[model samples]
Target: MCTIELCTIVLVMSDAPRLRHQVCFALYSASKAATAVYRPVLEDLGLTYPQYLVMLVLWEQEPRSVRDLGAELGLDSGTLSPLLKRLEAMGLVERRRSAEDERRVDVVLTDAGTALSARAQAVPQRLADAAGLSPDEIGQLHATLGKLTAALNSSL
Candidate 1:
Protein backbone atom coordinates (compact mmCIF):
# COMPACT_ATOMS: atom_id res chain seq x y z
CA MET A 1 0.00 0.00 0.00
CA CYS A 2 1.24 3.46 -0.87
CA THR A 3 -0.15 6.89 -0.15
CA ILE A 4 0.45 10.03 -2.22
CA GLU A 5 -0.68 13.42 -0.96
CA LEU A 6 -1.29 16.30 -3.34
CA CYS A 7 -2.40 19.89 -2.65
CA THR A 8 -5.70 18.88 -1.00
CA ILE A 9 -6.28 15.27 -1.93
CA VAL A 10 -4.75 11.92 -0.99
CA LEU A 11 -4.80 8.68 -2.98
CA VAL A 12 -3.98 5.21 -1.70
CA MET A 13 -3.11 2.13 -3.71
CA SER A 14 -2.84 -1.45 -2.51
CA ASP A 15 -0.55 -3.79 -4.39
CA ALA A 16 -0.11 -6.70 -2.01
CA PRO A 17 -1.55 -10.04 -3.05
CA ARG A 18 -3.98 -11.62 -0.61
CA LEU A 19 -3.19 -15.06 0.77
CA ARG A 20 -6.67 -16.32 -0.09
CA HIS A 21 -6.18 -15.09 -3.67
CA GLN A 22 -3.16 -17.27 -4.31
CA VAL A 23 -3.55 -20.49 -6.30
CA CYS A 24 -0.36 -21.84 -4.72
CA PHE A 25 -1.83 -21.33 -1.27
CA ALA A 26 -4.95 -23.26 -2.25
CA LEU A 27 -2.87 -26.12 -3.61
CA TYR A 28 -0.65 -26.14 -0.54
CA SER A 29 -3.61 -26.24 1.82
CA ALA A 30 -5.29 -29.01 -0.16
CA SER A 31 -2.11 -31.07 -0.16
CA LYS A 32 -1.73 -30.69 3.59
CA ALA A 33 -5.37 -31.53 4.24
CA ALA A 34 -5.19 -34.58 2.01
CA THR A 35 -2.07 -35.76 3.81
CA ALA A 36 -3.77 -35.22 7.15
CA VAL A 37 -6.57 -37.50 6.03
CA TYR A 38 -4.04 -40.21 5.25
CA ARG A 39 -2.07 -39.83 8.47
CA PRO A 40 -4.23 -41.81 10.89
CA VAL A 41 -5.05 -44.60 8.45
CA LEU A 42 -1.41 -44.90 7.51
CA GLU A 43 -0.36 -44.84 11.17
CA ASP A 44 -2.45 -47.97 11.70
CA LEU A 45 -0.15 -49.59 9.15
CA GLY A 46 2.93 -48.08 10.84
CA LEU A 47 3.81 -45.93 7.87
CA THR A 48 4.01 -42.25 7.09
CA TYR A 49 2.60 -40.98 3.82
CA PRO A 50 6.03 -40.79 2.20
CA GLN A 51 6.87 -44.29 3.35
CA TYR A 52 3.54 -45.54 2.10
CA LEU A 53 4.30 -44.00 -1.28
CA VAL A 54 7.64 -45.79 -1.43
CA MET A 55 6.01 -49.07 -0.57
CA LEU A 56 3.38 -48.52 -3.22
CA VAL A 57 6.07 -48.32 -5.89
CA LEU A 58 8.03 -51.27 -4.57
CA TRP A 59 4.86 -53.33 -4.36
CA GLU A 60 4.40 -52.79 -8.07
CA GLN A 61 7.77 -54.38 -8.90
CA GLU A 62 10.79 -56.06 -7.37
CA PRO A 63 14.52 -55.33 -7.22
CA ARG A 64 14.21 -51.76 -8.47
CA SER A 65 17.41 -49.74 -8.58
CA VAL A 66 17.50 -46.89 -6.05
CA ARG A 67 18.12 -44.37 -8.83
CA ASP A 68 15.21 -45.66 -10.90
CA LEU A 69 12.88 -45.70 -7.90
CA GLY A 70 13.82 -42.17 -6.93
CA ALA A 71 13.21 -40.86 -10.43
CA GLU A 72 9.71 -42.37 -10.52
CA LEU A 73 8.94 -40.84 -7.13
CA GLY A 74 10.44 -37.46 -8.02
CA LEU A 75 12.84 -37.65 -5.12
CA ASP A 76 16.61 -37.13 -4.82
CA SER A 77 18.98 -39.39 -2.90
CA GLY A 78 19.27 -37.11 0.12
CA THR A 79 15.55 -37.43 0.80
CA LEU A 80 15.02 -41.00 -0.40
CA SER A 81 17.99 -42.62 1.33
CA PRO A 82 16.74 -42.01 4.85
CA LEU A 83 13.19 -43.02 3.96
CA LEU A 84 14.48 -46.32 2.56
CA LYS A 85 16.57 -46.79 5.70
CA ARG A 86 13.51 -46.44 7.91
CA LEU A 87 11.54 -48.92 5.79
CA GLU A 88 14.45 -51.37 6.01
CA ALA A 89 14.53 -50.93 9.76
CA MET A 90 10.84 -51.77 9.85
CA GLY A 91 11.63 -55.01 8.00
CA LEU A 92 9.38 -53.88 5.20
CA VAL A 93 12.08 -53.51 2.60
CA GLU A 94 15.68 -54.44 1.92
CA ARG A 95 18.32 -52.45 0.10
CA ARG A 96 21.00 -54.50 -1.59
CA ARG A 97 23.85 -53.72 -3.92
CA SER A 98 23.08 -54.91 -7.44
CA ALA A 99 25.32 -57.77 -8.62
CA GLU A 100 25.07 -56.62 -12.22
CA ASP A 101 26.31 -53.14 -11.36
CA GLU A 102 28.55 -52.68 -8.34
CA ARG A 103 27.73 -48.99 -8.16
CA ARG A 104 23.97 -49.46 -8.07
CA VAL A 105 21.75 -50.27 -5.08
CA ASP A 106 18.37 -52.00 -5.44
CA VAL A 107 15.28 -51.92 -3.23
CA VAL A 108 13.08 -54.97 -2.85
CA LEU A 109 10.04 -55.60 -0.69
CA THR A 110 10.58 -57.97 2.19
CA ASP A 111 8.02 -60.58 3.32
CA ALA A 112 6.35 -58.05 5.57
CA GLY A 113 6.18 -55.53 2.75
CA THR A 114 4.68 -58.07 0.38
CA ALA A 115 1.99 -58.88 2.96
CA LEU A 116 1.25 -55.18 3.37
CA SER A 117 -0.15 -54.98 -0.14
CA ALA A 118 -3.13 -57.15 0.79
CA ARG A 119 -3.89 -54.90 3.75
CA ALA A 120 -3.58 -51.86 1.53
CA GLN A 121 -6.12 -53.08 -0.99
CA ALA A 122 -8.95 -51.33 0.83
CA VAL A 123 -7.08 -48.03 1.13
CA PRO A 124 -8.06 -46.68 -2.26
CA GLN A 125 -11.74 -47.28 -1.61
CA ARG A 126 -11.45 -45.63 1.79
CA LEU A 127 -9.92 -42.55 0.24
CA ALA A 128 -12.59 -42.53 -2.41
CA ASP A 129 -15.27 -42.59 0.25
CA ALA A 130 -13.55 -39.82 2.15
CA ALA A 131 -13.19 -37.68 -0.95
CA GLY A 132 -16.90 -37.99 -1.72
CA LEU A 133 -15.98 -37.84 -5.39
CA SER A 134 -17.62 -39.93 -8.03
CA PRO A 135 -15.36 -42.24 -10.00
CA ASP A 136 -15.49 -39.92 -13.01
CA GLU A 137 -14.70 -36.90 -10.85
CA ILE A 138 -11.72 -38.70 -9.34
CA GLY A 139 -10.49 -39.61 -12.79
CA GLN A 140 -10.80 -36.01 -13.96
CA LEU A 141 -9.07 -34.67 -10.89
CA HIS A 142 -6.21 -37.14 -11.34
CA ALA A 143 -5.78 -36.17 -14.98
CA THR A 144 -5.87 -32.44 -14.24
CA LEU A 145 -3.30 -32.73 -11.48
CA GLY A 146 -1.03 -34.78 -13.74
CA LYS A 147 -1.19 -32.08 -16.41
CA LEU A 148 -0.59 -29.39 -13.82
CA THR A 149 2.48 -31.20 -12.54
CA ALA A 150 3.83 -31.67 -16.03
CA ALA A 151 3.28 -28.01 -16.89
CA LEU A 152 5.00 -26.83 -13.70
CA ASN A 153 7.95 -29.18 -14.25
CA SER A 154 8.38 -28.07 -17.84
CA SER A 155 8.28 -24.46 -16.71
CA LEU A 156 11.09 -25.19 -14.30
Candidate 2:
Protein backbone atom coordinates (compact mmCIF):
# COMPACT_ATOMS: atom_id res chain seq x y z
CA MET A 1 0.00 0.00 0.00
CA CYS A 2 1.15 3.53 -0.73
CA THR A 3 0.01 6.83 0.67
CA ILE A 4 0.82 10.39 -0.32
CA GLU A 5 0.16 13.79 1.08
CA LEU A 6 -1.08 16.57 -1.11
CA CYS A 7 1.51 19.07 0.04
CA THR A 8 1.17 21.72 -2.60
CA ILE A 9 -1.01 22.72 -5.54
CA VAL A 10 -1.71 25.74 -7.73
CA LEU A 11 -4.71 26.74 -9.81
CA VAL A 12 -4.54 28.46 -13.18
CA MET A 13 -7.83 29.98 -14.30
CA SER A 14 -9.21 32.37 -16.88
CA ASP A 15 -12.37 33.43 -15.06
CA ALA A 16 -12.06 33.02 -11.36
CA PRO A 17 -14.73 34.77 -9.29
CA ARG A 18 -13.88 38.40 -8.63
CA LEU A 19 -14.01 37.75 -4.91
CA ARG A 20 -11.41 35.01 -5.28
CA HIS A 21 -8.61 37.36 -6.35
CA GLN A 22 -10.06 40.61 -5.10
CA VAL A 23 -8.06 42.94 -2.85
CA CYS A 24 -10.40 42.10 0.05
CA PHE A 25 -9.41 38.44 -0.08
CA ALA A 26 -5.74 39.37 -0.37
CA LEU A 27 -6.02 41.55 2.73
CA TYR A 28 -7.97 38.86 4.57
CA SER A 29 -5.45 36.14 3.77
CA ALA A 30 -2.50 38.36 4.55
CA SER A 31 -4.07 39.29 7.90
CA LYS A 32 -4.72 35.64 8.75
CA ALA A 33 -1.21 34.58 7.73
CA ALA A 34 0.38 37.45 9.58
CA THR A 35 -1.63 36.66 12.70
CA ALA A 36 -0.55 33.01 12.41
CA VAL A 37 3.06 34.15 12.28
CA TYR A 38 2.43 36.28 15.33
CA ARG A 39 0.61 33.58 17.29
CA PRO A 40 3.61 32.22 19.15
CA VAL A 41 5.02 35.65 19.67
CA LEU A 42 1.71 37.00 20.94
CA GLU A 43 1.12 33.90 23.04
CA ASP A 44 4.33 34.69 24.82
CA LEU A 45 2.77 38.03 25.65
CA GLY A 46 -0.47 36.33 26.69
CA LEU A 47 -2.65 37.95 24.02
CA THR A 48 -4.76 36.81 21.09
CA TYR A 49 -4.88 38.36 17.58
CA PRO A 50 -7.86 40.63 18.14
CA GLN A 51 -6.60 41.48 21.58
CA TYR A 52 -3.30 42.49 20.06
CA LEU A 53 -5.07 44.76 17.59
CA VAL A 54 -6.97 46.34 20.44
CA MET A 55 -3.75 46.77 22.35
CA LEU A 56 -2.11 48.31 19.29
CA VAL A 57 -4.71 51.06 19.26
CA LEU A 58 -4.56 51.60 22.98
CA TRP A 59 -0.81 51.71 22.87
CA GLU A 60 -0.89 54.65 20.49
CA GLN A 61 -3.44 56.45 22.65
CA GLU A 62 -4.83 56.03 26.10
CA PRO A 63 -8.36 55.93 27.53
CA ARG A 64 -10.24 55.37 24.30
CA SER A 65 -13.93 54.47 24.40
CA VAL A 66 -15.00 51.02 23.26
CA ARG A 67 -16.82 52.54 20.30
CA ASP A 68 -13.67 54.37 19.27
CA LEU A 69 -11.62 51.19 19.43
CA GLY A 70 -14.19 49.34 17.35
CA ALA A 71 -14.32 52.12 14.78
CA GLU A 72 -10.51 52.23 14.54
CA LEU A 73 -10.34 48.48 14.01
CA GLY A 74 -13.44 48.16 11.81
CA LEU A 75 -15.07 45.82 14.32
CA ASP A 76 -18.58 45.74 15.70
CA SER A 77 -19.47 45.58 19.38
CA GLY A 78 -20.68 42.00 19.09
CA THR A 79 -17.17 40.87 18.14
CA LEU A 80 -15.27 43.28 20.36
CA SER A 81 -17.27 42.95 23.53
CA PRO A 82 -16.17 39.45 24.49
CA LEU A 83 -12.57 40.15 23.58
CA LEU A 84 -12.63 43.26 25.74
CA LYS A 85 -14.09 41.24 28.58
CA ARG A 86 -11.23 38.76 28.35
CA LEU A 87 -8.69 41.57 28.38
CA GLU A 88 -10.39 43.02 31.44
CA ALA A 89 -10.21 39.62 33.08
CA MET A 90 -6.50 39.48 32.38
CA GLY A 91 -6.19 42.86 34.16
CA LEU A 92 -4.53 44.35 31.10
CA VAL A 93 -7.24 46.91 30.62
CA GLU A 94 -9.88 48.53 32.74
CA ARG A 95 -13.34 49.32 31.41
CA ARG A 96 -15.28 52.13 32.95
CA ARG A 97 -18.52 53.88 32.23
CA SER A 98 -18.13 57.49 31.33
CA ALA A 99 -19.48 60.00 33.84
CA GLU A 100 -20.49 62.52 31.20
CA ASP A 101 -21.90 59.86 28.89
CA GLU A 102 -23.26 56.91 30.81
CA ARG A 103 -23.98 55.08 27.59
CA ARG A 104 -20.31 55.12 26.56
CA VAL A 105 -17.59 52.86 27.95
CA ASP A 106 -13.91 53.75 28.01
CA VAL A 107 -10.99 51.34 27.87
CA VAL A 108 -7.83 52.22 29.68
CA LEU A 109 -4.62 50.21 29.85
CA THR A 110 -3.26 49.11 33.19
CA ASP A 111 0.31 49.48 34.37
CA ALA A 112 0.98 45.95 33.21
CA GLY A 113 -0.49 46.73 29.82
CA THR A 114 1.73 49.78 29.45
CA ALA A 115 4.76 47.67 30.39
CA LEU A 116 3.80 45.03 27.82
CA SER A 117 4.61 47.55 25.12
CA ALA A 118 8.36 47.21 25.68
CA ARG A 119 8.14 43.56 24.73
CA ALA A 120 5.73 44.14 21.84
CA GLN A 121 7.74 46.93 20.29
CA ALA A 122 9.80 44.36 18.43
CA VAL A 123 6.88 42.53 16.78
CA PRO A 124 6.95 44.54 13.55
CA GLN A 125 10.64 43.86 13.07
CA ARG A 126 10.14 40.18 13.83
CA LEU A 127 7.30 39.97 11.31
CA ALA A 128 9.41 41.72 8.67
CA ASP A 129 12.29 39.35 9.31
CA ALA A 130 10.09 36.25 9.25
CA ALA A 131 8.44 37.38 5.99
CA GLY A 132 11.90 37.63 4.38
CA LEU A 133 10.67 40.64 2.43
CA SER A 134 13.02 43.46 1.61
CA PRO A 135 12.23 47.02 2.69
CA ASP A 136 11.32 47.89 -0.90
CA GLU A 137 8.99 44.92 -1.15
CA ILE A 138 7.31 45.85 2.12
CA GLY A 139 6.84 49.41 0.88
CA GLN A 140 5.33 48.18 -2.39
CA LEU A 141 2.99 45.89 -0.49
CA HIS A 142 1.91 48.77 1.74
CA ALA A 143 1.27 50.98 -1.27
CA THR A 144 -0.80 48.32 -3.02
CA LEU A 145 -2.76 47.52 0.10
CA GLY A 146 -3.34 51.20 0.85
CA LYS A 147 -4.79 51.75 -2.61
CA LEU A 148 -7.02 48.70 -2.31
CA THR A 149 -8.26 49.62 1.14
CA ALA A 150 -8.98 53.18 0.08
CA ALA A 151 -10.94 52.00 -2.96
CA LEU A 152 -12.98 49.56 -0.89
CA ASN A 153 -13.70 52.17 1.78
CA SER A 154 -14.79 54.64 -0.90
CA SER A 155 -17.06 52.03 -2.46
CA LEU A 156 -18.73 51.57 0.90
Candidate 3:
Protein backbone atom coordinates (compact mmCIF):
# COMPACT_ATOMS: atom_id res chain seq x y z
CA MET A 1 0.00 0.00 0.00
CA CYS A 2 1.28 3.50 -0.85
CA THR A 3 0.21 6.70 0.96
CA ILE A 4 0.44 10.30 -0.40
CA GLU A 5 0.64 13.41 1.83
CA LEU A 6 -0.85 16.77 0.74
CA CYS A 7 0.16 20.17 2.16
CA THR A 8 -1.63 23.51 1.91
CA ILE A 9 -0.03 26.94 2.30
CA VAL A 10 -1.62 30.39 2.68
CA LEU A 11 0.01 33.68 1.86
CA VAL A 12 -0.74 36.78 3.85
CA MET A 13 -1.51 40.10 2.22
CA SER A 14 0.55 43.23 2.80
CA ASP A 15 -0.91 46.35 4.45
CA ALA A 16 0.52 48.51 1.65
CA PRO A 17 -1.88 50.77 -0.23
CA ARG A 18 -2.77 49.98 -3.83
CA LEU A 19 -4.64 51.74 -6.64
CA ARG A 20 -7.33 49.07 -6.74
CA HIS A 21 -8.02 49.66 -3.04
CA GLN A 22 -8.51 53.42 -3.47
CA VAL A 23 -11.97 54.72 -2.52
CA CYS A 24 -11.70 57.82 -4.72
CA PHE A 25 -10.87 55.77 -7.83
CA ALA A 26 -13.65 53.33 -7.04
CA LEU A 27 -16.13 56.19 -6.73
CA TYR A 28 -14.88 57.76 -9.94
CA SER A 29 -15.11 54.49 -11.85
CA ALA A 30 -18.57 53.73 -10.50
CA SER A 31 -19.75 57.22 -11.42
CA LYS A 32 -18.51 56.80 -14.98
CA ALA A 33 -20.14 53.39 -15.26
CA ALA A 34 -23.46 54.67 -13.93
CA THR A 35 -23.34 57.67 -16.27
CA ALA A 36 -22.67 55.34 -19.22
CA VAL A 37 -25.89 53.52 -18.42
CA TYR A 38 -27.77 56.81 -18.28
CA ARG A 39 -26.36 58.21 -21.51
CA PRO A 40 -28.40 56.32 -24.10
CA VAL A 41 -31.58 56.41 -22.08
CA LEU A 42 -31.26 60.16 -21.59
CA GLU A 43 -30.40 60.69 -25.26
CA ASP A 44 -33.65 59.02 -26.30
CA LEU A 45 -35.42 61.72 -24.25
CA GLY A 46 -33.43 64.47 -25.98
CA LEU A 47 -31.49 65.30 -22.81
CA THR A 48 -27.93 64.89 -21.62
CA TYR A 49 -27.12 63.48 -18.20
CA PRO A 50 -26.53 66.89 -16.62
CA GLN A 51 -29.67 68.25 -18.25
CA TYR A 52 -31.62 65.29 -16.94
CA LEU A 53 -30.34 66.01 -13.43
CA VAL A 54 -31.56 69.58 -13.74
CA MET A 55 -34.92 68.36 -14.99
CA LEU A 56 -35.22 65.98 -12.07
CA VAL A 57 -34.89 68.83 -9.56
CA LEU A 58 -37.28 71.00 -11.56
CA TRP A 59 -39.76 68.15 -11.77
CA GLU A 60 -39.80 68.03 -7.99
CA GLN A 61 -40.18 71.81 -7.66
CA GLU A 62 -40.63 74.27 -10.47
CA PRO A 63 -39.55 77.89 -10.83
CA ARG A 64 -36.48 77.60 -8.61
CA SER A 65 -33.93 80.41 -8.57
CA VAL A 66 -30.69 79.75 -10.46
CA ARG A 67 -28.75 80.23 -7.23
CA ASP A 68 -30.91 77.63 -5.50
CA LEU A 69 -30.58 75.22 -8.39
CA GLY A 70 -26.81 75.69 -8.41
CA ALA A 71 -26.65 74.98 -4.69
CA GLU A 72 -28.75 71.86 -5.03
CA LEU A 73 -26.76 70.58 -8.00
CA GLY A 74 -23.31 71.61 -6.70
CA LEU A 75 -22.66 73.70 -9.82
CA ASP A 76 -21.62 77.28 -10.42
CA SER A 77 -23.19 79.88 -12.73
CA GLY A 78 -20.36 79.50 -15.23
CA THR A 79 -21.20 75.83 -15.77
CA LEU A 80 -24.97 76.08 -15.36
CA SER A 81 -25.61 79.09 -17.59
CA PRO A 82 -24.94 77.25 -20.85
CA LEU A 83 -26.96 74.23 -19.77
CA LEU A 84 -29.96 76.45 -18.99
CA LYS A 85 -29.44 78.20 -22.30
CA ARG A 86 -29.63 74.92 -24.21
CA LEU A 87 -32.70 73.78 -22.32
CA GLU A 88 -34.32 77.12 -23.04
CA ALA A 89 -33.50 76.78 -26.71
CA MET A 90 -35.10 73.35 -26.72
CA GLY A 91 -38.31 74.84 -25.24
CA LEU A 92 -37.91 72.53 -22.26
CA VAL A 93 -37.30 75.31 -19.72
CA GLU A 94 -37.53 79.04 -19.30
CA ARG A 95 -35.18 81.30 -17.38
CA ARG A 96 -36.21 84.71 -16.10
CA ARG A 97 -35.07 87.34 -13.65
CA SER A 98 -36.89 87.17 -10.34
CA ALA A 99 -39.60 89.79 -10.00
CA GLU A 100 -38.41 90.89 -6.56
CA ASP A 101 -34.71 90.35 -7.12
CA GLU A 102 -33.15 91.28 -10.43
CA ARG A 103 -29.91 89.64 -9.37
CA ARG A 104 -31.68 86.32 -9.05
CA VAL A 105 -32.69 84.28 -12.08
CA ASP A 106 -35.35 81.62 -11.84
CA VAL A 107 -35.75 78.49 -13.93
CA VAL A 108 -39.15 77.12 -14.78
CA LEU A 109 -39.97 74.09 -16.90
CA THR A 110 -42.09 74.49 -20.00
CA ASP A 111 -45.24 72.52 -20.76
CA ALA A 112 -43.11 70.15 -22.79
CA GLY A 113 -40.74 69.71 -19.87
CA THR A 114 -43.62 68.94 -17.53
CA ALA A 115 -45.01 66.45 -20.03
CA LEU A 116 -41.62 64.81 -20.36
CA SER A 117 -41.73 63.89 -16.67
CA ALA A 118 -44.33 61.25 -17.41
CA ARG A 119 -41.91 59.55 -19.76
CA ALA A 120 -39.01 60.02 -17.35
CA GLN A 121 -40.98 58.22 -14.67
CA ALA A 122 -39.82 54.97 -16.22
CA VAL A 123 -36.15 55.89 -16.02
CA PRO A 124 -35.56 54.81 -12.41
CA GLN A 125 -36.86 51.30 -12.94
CA ARG A 126 -34.93 50.92 -16.17
CA LEU A 127 -31.73 52.19 -14.55
CA ALA A 128 -32.20 49.84 -11.63
CA ASP A 129 -32.63 46.90 -14.01
CA ALA A 130 -29.56 47.94 -15.98
CA ALA A 131 -27.49 48.26 -12.81
CA GLY A 132 -28.66 44.83 -11.66
CA LEU A 133 -29.44 46.22 -8.22
CA SER A 134 -32.72 45.99 -6.37
CA PRO A 135 -34.49 49.14 -5.20
CA ASP A 136 -33.46 48.46 -1.59
CA GLU A 137 -29.85 48.02 -2.63
CA ILE A 138 -29.92 51.25 -4.61
CA GLY A 139 -31.43 53.08 -1.66
CA GLN A 140 -28.73 51.76 0.66
CA LEU A 141 -26.03 52.73 -1.81
CA HIS A 142 -27.50 56.21 -2.19
CA ALA A 143 -27.61 56.67 1.56
CA THR A 144 -24.03 55.51 1.97
CA LEU A 145 -22.82 57.79 -0.82
CA GLY A 146 -24.68 60.70 0.69
CA LYS A 147 -22.86 60.12 3.95
CA LEU A 148 -19.55 59.94 2.12
CA THR A 149 -20.30 63.20 0.31
CA ALA A 150 -21.26 64.89 3.56
CA ALA A 151 -18.06 63.76 5.21
CA LEU A 152 -15.92 65.00 2.34
CA ASN A 153 -17.75 68.30 2.23
CA SER A 154 -17.26 68.81 5.93
CA SER A 155 -13.57 68.03 5.63
CA LEU A 156 -13.23 70.58 2.85
TM-score of each: 0.89, 0.82, 0.87
Q: Candidate 1 residues 1-156, lDDT tens each?
A: 233355224322244567989989988988897888888889889999999999999998888999998999999999999999999999999999999999999999999999999988877777888889999999999999899999999999
- Evaluated against the true structure, the overall lDDT of model 1 is 0.89
lDDT (CA) for every model shown? 0.89, 0.89, 0.90
Per-residue accuracy of model 2 over 84-128 as CA lDDT, tens digit each: 999999989999999899999999999999999999988888789
TM-score of 1: 0.89
Superposed on all Cα atoms, model 1 deviates from the true structure by an RMSD in Å of: 3.2
Give per-residue CA lDDT, model 3, range 78-154, as digits (tens): 99999999999999999998999999889999999999999898887777898888788999999999999999999
Extract clashing residue pairs from model 3.
none
Q: Output the better candidate (1/3) by TM-score.
A: 1
- Candidate 3 structure, TM-score to reference: 0.87
Q: Which sections of candidate 3 miss by over 4 Å?
A: 1-16
For model 1, the run of ten residues with the poorest summed lDDT: 4-13
Q: Where does the lowest 10-residue lDDT sum fall in candidate 3?
A: 1-10
